[model samples]
Target chain A: MATILVADDFHENRDVLCRMLRLVGHSTISAANGQEALDMAQEHRPDLILMDLSMPIVDGWKATAILKTTSDLRHIPIIAVTGHVTPDEINRAISAGCADYLAKPVDFERLLGKVASLLGDTQRPPFLSS
Target chain B: MKLSIRTKLLAALGLDLALMLILGSFALNQMSAMNEEATFVAAQTIPSIDTVNTINDILLSYRNLQVEYIINVASADKLRIEGEMHHLEEDMAKAFITYDHFQLDENERATFEQTRAGWEQFVTATHTQFIPSNRDSNTGNVHPSFSRLAPLYDNLLSHVRQIKQQSQQRATTALGRVRAAYDASRLVILSETTLTIVVSAVIGLTLSSNIARRIRKLRDATMAIAGGDLNQTVALRGSDELQLLANNFNLMVASLRQQHLLLAQRNTELSESLETQRKLMSDLVQRKQAEEAADRARATAEAASQAKSMFLATMSHELRTPLNAILGYVQLLHLEAQIRGNTDMLPDLERIRSAGKHLLTIISNILDFSKIEQGKMNLEIDTFEISSVANEVIGIFSPLAHSRGIDLTLICPPEIGLMRSDAGKVRQVLFNLLSNAVKFTERGHITLTISHEYHSGKAWIFFSVADTGIGINPEQMGRLFQAFSQVHHNTFHHYGGTGLGLALSRQLCQMLGGDITVESETGKGSVFSVCLPADIGTVQATRQTHVLHTNGNLPRHIPGSVPSLTPGEETAVVASPTSMTQRDA
Candidate 1:
């Protein structure tokens, strides 16, 4: 299972997204804000990061920028998750170092497909061992 | 006349009175002298001369008469001699009394008396003989005694003549003395009259000169006042009414100066107050304008916020509808693949794939709209044939329009040349309009017309898409060009659209110094017109004259690739052959 980090400000949305990832047979870690996500990303170095753009305290854009610059976190693919998904917003996320984008309320299948595509059944990191 | 004025008036009165007195006294003295001279002339000299002349005439006449009487008595008879002698005696006595009273000088009087005595002696001799002649003449007889006495009478007459000569000499001396006295008295009277006249004339001249001098001073002061010299004073020097007038004039000038000063001060104060009031009023107006400007800014911000909220709601609806299709199709594909032992549902899978693809396109349009709103879209300008672009857009809608029993037509001018513009953006705008026309029209033909017109040394190209379909209402037409606005509330129910196409088209047109306009009526049709500058080559007649090429023979195809079928198609295809084997087992 690939390790995935899901960051969202709303608890219900975060829980639903994490549940979907788990159903897809991926090891899931969750954070409530971009700052918590960044901390988790530095510590666990998840295979892929799912970022919510409209979070409080260091939004997805700034967090993604920080992660893109960091040597350790740069390898992880960050996918932007937002309810307000427009082509311009997606382009903005892509420019901000997100590998791809998914809009909410997310289609569980599309979310799963994007995760599968970015991770590609990659090896799990040692720290993510269950 | 009080204080200064009284002093001046008193002085003026004193001076005038003194002048009057001097003139009057001089005149009076002169008149008195004249009266005294006249009296002296009339009472003393004239009376004395008359008396002296009268006495001289009387004595001389008497002496002559006495001589005549003596001659007559001596030469006549005794009776004639007695009558002449009596007449001579009476004449002599009358002359003696006149001489006594008329002679003023003592020597003249004595001469007059001696003349009278000679007359008396001759009379006495003649009287003695006169009686007898008178008696004889009465008896009517002439006496011979009178004739015989003629020689004696001649002798007596000669004696009487001598006496008469002596009296006439004394009388001439008396007349000469009287004439000398009259001439001396006239000389004295004439000298006094001249003195009085000269004195009166000098006094009148002095009085008139003083009055004239005072009047001239008053006239000068009045002229100075008329000349606008209010400070001038009439300082007349005299003890007369003119001096009092000058004092009053000075007081009037002082009052005028005070009033002028007060008026000037009041005017300055009024002007300053007016200036302050004007400044205050202007400041109030400026403050009011500032407040109005702030109010306008607030209203603008509120309007912007409301528009943003409207955009958000529309976006939510637009995103939700497409997402439902995409998610629903994916779920169906996954579930159906699991149900069949061998799954290959190509048609259902293709529908899912196309739906997903359409959702992607819609999302992309949303992103583009956001970029345009954020002012991030950049145009890439290049030169391309404008007819080709129009042909491509026409090709895109032709299939869809045909499927709906609507004819799609494109008319391009014969030899349109290259146009310099952002080809991609222009193509997008054209595609959006054409596709919208095709989607909205259920029947009836849609035609896109293009033409070029030359105006003011420049070539302008007009492009219009005209459609005969269900059209927009007049009220909703205004809102059609606004971002994310639909024609009616149920517009989404009838036709699915993002509604940003016409707004973006207008924005693009405006960027190129052109604009898009629309004309529409409910159930009649719609026409959208776009005007833009043509390229230089298109403006040249030589290039336009070349044989025009048409796309009549060109094969048309979809510009972008289509996505493949979903996984449901693979399962359905595999499951078909396995149906008999499963039953046999």
Candidate 2:
């Protein structure tokens, strides 16, 4: 299983995301805000990072920018999770160093697919695994 | 002299000639009268003196004969002689008186007076002797009387002789005096005739010469004036009124010369001023024309600006509709790939879709802003249920909100009426607000509230989206509704939205005579409100209240079995293993 980090300010959203990741047989870590997520990323060095864009202390855009520029963390793919997925917002995420974006209440299947595709060589279990 | 001066001079000469003629004629008339009177006196005196001398001679002869007859005859003869003597005495007395009164001057008067005395003595002696004898006797007495009277006759003859002598003397003296008087009268006639001739000749010559000289001067002056030499003055050399006339003519010519010079100068000035005025008028006309041209150009430029804005709006609409289809299909494809476990193409497809969508949104914003500038955006008003619209917008956003642990809620009063507005625009506005709430809120609830009120006989529908999220600052609020404006600089960077939704919503509200407003505190949350007019006739059914409960407390997903790739496999496969392996690679 590929190790992943999920950063979100809301507990319910984090729980739901964690449940979906476990169903697919991926090990996941959770953080409440962008700063916590950054600390978790540095500490764990997860294969992929799932970022919630609107957060206290540091937003997903700043966190992504800092992570992409850091030498040790630059190779990790970052995906933005947001509620409003307008074209301008998607482009902004890409420009801010996110590998891909998913609009929130994110579809379980789509999220799993994006995580799988961004991970490339990292094998993960199917999302519907019993 | 000028013409008038010459005229006056000639008139004076004419007057002088007339006076000379009158005086000369009067003198001639007096001289002729004197000549006639002298001729008449000379002829009458000579004829009277001859007659007197003849009478005196006859009287002397008759006196001698009468004396002889008186001495020789008797008394009868004496008496006859006495009668004859009386007659002779009367005759002699008349002759003596005539001779005395005929005296010429001192030289002729003495001879005439002596002749008269001798004649009177003879007459007296004859009368005394002849009268005495005639009274006595006849023939005898006549003889005695004749002898006595012979001596007396002789004496009388002597007195007669003396008388003849005196008569002769008187005659001679009278003749001499008459001759002298005739000589003096002839001398006077000759002197008068000579003086009349000389005076007439002198006056005629003087008058004729003066008139001729004046006429010549007048002719010369008239010629000079006709030759255009107006400056030349005719010299008037007389003290007559002709000099006054010449002075007046010179004054008239001077005045005419001054007037001519003044008139020429005035004409030149008038022409120059007219030219200047004409130039000024033309300049004014040209300036007005230029101003009119500029005004026309300004109007044309304004018209072009309006046309350009209209073109942009139409092009944006035409372009965005197709872009929407492209992006929507691409998103669907990306989701389908993930569900099928074919995730290798997901990243490239998402990139292409996002890039297209981003360009599309920029085009849409530019078009919308242009439409607003041109005042061409209009509302499509329709009647719709407020609750239904709210539910639809909420449904679209609920999944997103749920994933973020944001509680999204809809609060519509059961008594709320159906709203009348542009349903499409209202939906767009609500959808933007609700979605923004869901995106911004992380741990807090987002609510869509709907209410209705009556004001001034019109139903007003008020809708609001409130969220407990990171709210906007007051400073950023002013720019919140401007096109392409984001509340926070990082909003576009973090949240994915075009940023044109709020601006378009505000424009839509303004079209419907309504507005959108916001109330928020930073770090707490935000509430965006929209007020719209409700349709009068549409009625909404009252909502039924129910106690909603969920058995699993977790959001449910569709539970149909996942299609398996291998028929014999017991576990439901999400995707083919080979495709999953290709995605992982």
| Top of the candidates by TM-score | 1
Candidate with the greatest lDDT versus the true structure: 2
B28-126: candidate 1 lDDT, tens digit per residue? 655565565565455544544444444344434434443343344443554354454445456545545543554244554454444445444434443
| For model 2 chain B, the run of ten residues with the poorest summed lDDT | B576-585
lDDT of 1 at B70: 36
lDDT (0-100) at residue B457 of candidate 1?
62
**CA displacement after TM-score superposition, residue B545 of candidate 2 (Å):** 52
lDDT of 2 by residue, B44-73 (tens): 355446535555565666656664564455
- lDDT score, candidate 2, position B39: 52
Q: Residue B295 of model 1: what lDDT?
A: 88
Taking the candidates in order, what DockQ does each have?
0.04, 0.02
